[model samples]
Target: MFDVLQVGQQHGTSTDRSRIGAEPVLLSLSPTIVGSRGGAMVTMRSGQAAQAALREEHWQEMERFGDFLTDEDLAALPQTIRDGLIGVRRPGGMRYPAFQIVNWGDGTKEVPPAWLQLVELLAPAGWNDEFLILWTSAPNAYLEGASPAQTIQSFPTEVTAELRYAAERAIPTRPGGPGSWQ
Candidate 1:
């Protein structure tokens, strides 16, 4: 588990009168964004700091008749959004990123806004969903060790900034010219 020292003031002032101080308060954070001020910290009970889990390249079936999503739901998305999905093939068959599908119950589903934006940004940069899935799920230093997916769901603004930073970092610089390759 990793400990992210969050200064409360860095986020924003809270109206709650019970808080310790008006200034920043150091918080122990976790893997997922907790409350607005505190986050769920990954446990480090083993004495050694826990690292973010490495993502494997394998894909899950987009049409899996499972609780996550179904074939009919995938068919219901707008064509443009549907086309934007990254497809991969393993020995089994074509599959999509499991993270892209959000189950809202009653068989309803939605793709996250942050996720869609990241896909749009990365597509022009020659980055694919395979890269996106891994990158977004992996722990990020900019997010204070939180994964992009986790940050996006709770702290929307922070995630957008992180995305912009990523785009800037991914832009290729020419040897002597100002223009980027893409």
Candidate 2:
């Protein structure tokens, strides 16, 4: 029951530019146990445990997959989507390691291998937390050639329209793709 949000101005003139606002991305995610490589546990203080469990289940599915997609599929993404996802990282402001997860679909075609693989790679295990949900929607800030813009380097700023726009744009929506999850 959480929505991701981001804050930062679009920098540069397109080519040699970048977004240098916050880091670590304070995820407004659902509460769940984060398993680390060493099996340490940390929980979110302001989120739902059940929802976090569900999200973990989704991520686990990705971990179970090995090369579920092909190079062709990754390359096929709209250039914007590809660029956006290819080099994404957690926002720097975060106190601990975290990622803004996205809800795409339950299939290979609908979800990319890199993204699928990333969810697993980034979500190694150890840290955990309770997530917070908002009544408003997120943004659509899809990257240049990566996965749809679902996750955002977020902070506690009271989810605003501007934040939603950034998220939506970050997430590259395929012309006739699935809508946002409640």
Candidate 3:
């Protein structure tokens, strides 16, 4: 068993330009760790694995999302809920990936159900938000050219299959899975 903890600073940093702080997100992985890419593999203890993973990637905050969303728009959403959006506490502020908030082009915005299921599945495992965002944003062979988030909005069946694959890969109990520290 592993314990994961994440606490954000009360304020944001000058670089990130928002109210997010350095989140020492604690992730507990199994004896064997999976690299950020789904198929790559590594062997390390949980703590070392977590630190190494954090060092491997950088996170961008909500402010960087450009026209997709504004501070006012994010404020309108419920901050405490994981729901469909994934928020990471960064030195600059609470940032979300641009893909999480889809612009319908008709002025209606909605979170895809598949996206929400993936977030809910991985969050409790202490999966870093960076990893989560990367997985969703990265290209997958199963979804053709679209990332998971995009597929979630455009193809319902593809999204469900993708989410199932992600969950299987992220948890260690399932063999050949993408193993997390926990």
Candidate 4:
């Protein structure tokens, strides 16, 4: 059995521009292993083992994104270009999602026109990098089950509308009246 622990602020680093003054929240996995040898045998994973497993899992997830640029890789690019893309900070380093950029294969990367608008729409929300990555990758109801990352390029207008609606909902409002708390 594995239990997840939400660890707050493992490192004081964030790649997401919108998440100023905020650090990435890390999830640690703690697992208890059970075996049967004509009976029941139980073993507990040490802290270091759990951490190593978590790091491995993070790398596996990163690989699923296909090709990504690290923080060091992005440092070679212009600041404006770096600011236009979204990056998530993981155990080892920051990873910029490749879907937002067009790799020219000559060590050059360009942000698509629609990505600029998408980043702008997401900036004011102050969303952390983890949430930003998950939101973009996950199937959205507003998109009729299409992921934002998948449709943002082809359906920029629709993606923009969905982002606007999501941003509006993210704002906390006093439903009762001024000075009222929910």
The candidate that achieves the highest lDDT relative to the unseen native structure? 4
Residue 66 miss distance in model 2 (angstroms): 13
Assess every candidate by TM-score: 0.45, 0.21, 0.48, 0.49
Clashes of 3: 11
Ten residues in sequence with the least summed lDDT for candidate 3: 4-13
- The per-residue C-alpha lDDT of model 4 at residue 118 equals 64
Each model's lDDT comes to 0.52, 0.34, 0.57, 0.63
Ranking the candidates on TM-score from highest down gives 4, 3, 1, 2
Best by TM-score: 4
Better of 3 and 4 by lDDT: 4
Those runs of model 1 whose alpha carbons end farther than 4 Å from true positions after fitting are: 1-84, 103-108, 155-159, 175-182
Candidate 2 accuracy as TM-score: 0.21
Q: Give a tens-digit lDDT track for model 1, residues 41-117.
A: 44342222222222332223223432132334457776654664555544455555555654455776556666677
**Could you give me the TM-score of model 1 versus the true structure?**
0.45
Residues 1-182 of candidate 4 have per-residue lDDT tens digits of: 55443455333334678887787744335434444435866455666457656655655775676557788888888887787777776657778877776655587656766667666666665677766666676566767787677776555434467655654454444575322355
For 8-102, candidate 2 gives per-residue lDDT tens digits of 53323323235455343334333334444346555543344566657555434433553123335446555544433322112222121112223
Poorly placed runs, candidate 2 (over 4 Å): 1-38, 43-48, 58-72, 84-182
Best first by lDDT, ranked: 4, 3, 1, 2
Worst 10 contiguous positions by lDDT, candidate 1:
45-54
Q: Give the Å error, residue 15, model 2.
A: 66
| Residue 105 CA displacement from its true place in model 4, Å | 12
